[model samples]
Target: MNSATTTTTKSRALRRFALHATSTCATQAEAYGKCILATYTDVRKDACKEEFAKFGACLRESVRLPRK
Candidate 1:
């Protein structure tokens, strides 16, 4: 497989982990602030910036607190 394929797979895995993680958080706030987001942004590889954005989008879509 090519580098693009590898990066895409890894990004998908990151999103999957976020989904599973949110399902188990003590609170939506906890899920929203899951450490992986920060860690990924802080240490991201330049080549995978697009994939990181995809991961961020997945978190935004999957890990929100319910409206009051």
Candidate 2:
């Protein structure tokens, strides 16, 4: 393949990665927010913490991001 073609392909790949990462991060944020609300209003703190840990880890692994 030509250099120009390869570069275009790479650019597309990066854009797709950015889109997926952004979406995944947003989902993780929402889940954490809900978990926090649940902890405050109804759920046990330790149970909520465990749920957060498990869910957050799954998301991070999927997107190759560190737990923030």
Top lDDT model: 2
Q: What is candidate 2's lDDT per residue for 23-61, written digit by digit as tens?
A: 755665567678787667665647567656755675557
Q: How far off is residue 49 in model 1, in Å?
A: 33
lDDT of each: 0.58, 0.67
- Lowest-scoring 10 consecutive residues by lDDT in candidate 1? 24-33
Find the candidate with the highest TM-score and give its number.
2
Error of 1 at 2 (Å): 7.5
Score every model by TM-score. 0.33, 0.37
lDDT of 1: 0.58
Each candidate structure's count of clashing pairs: 0, 0
The local lDDT score (0 to 100) that residue 29 gets in candidate 2 is 57
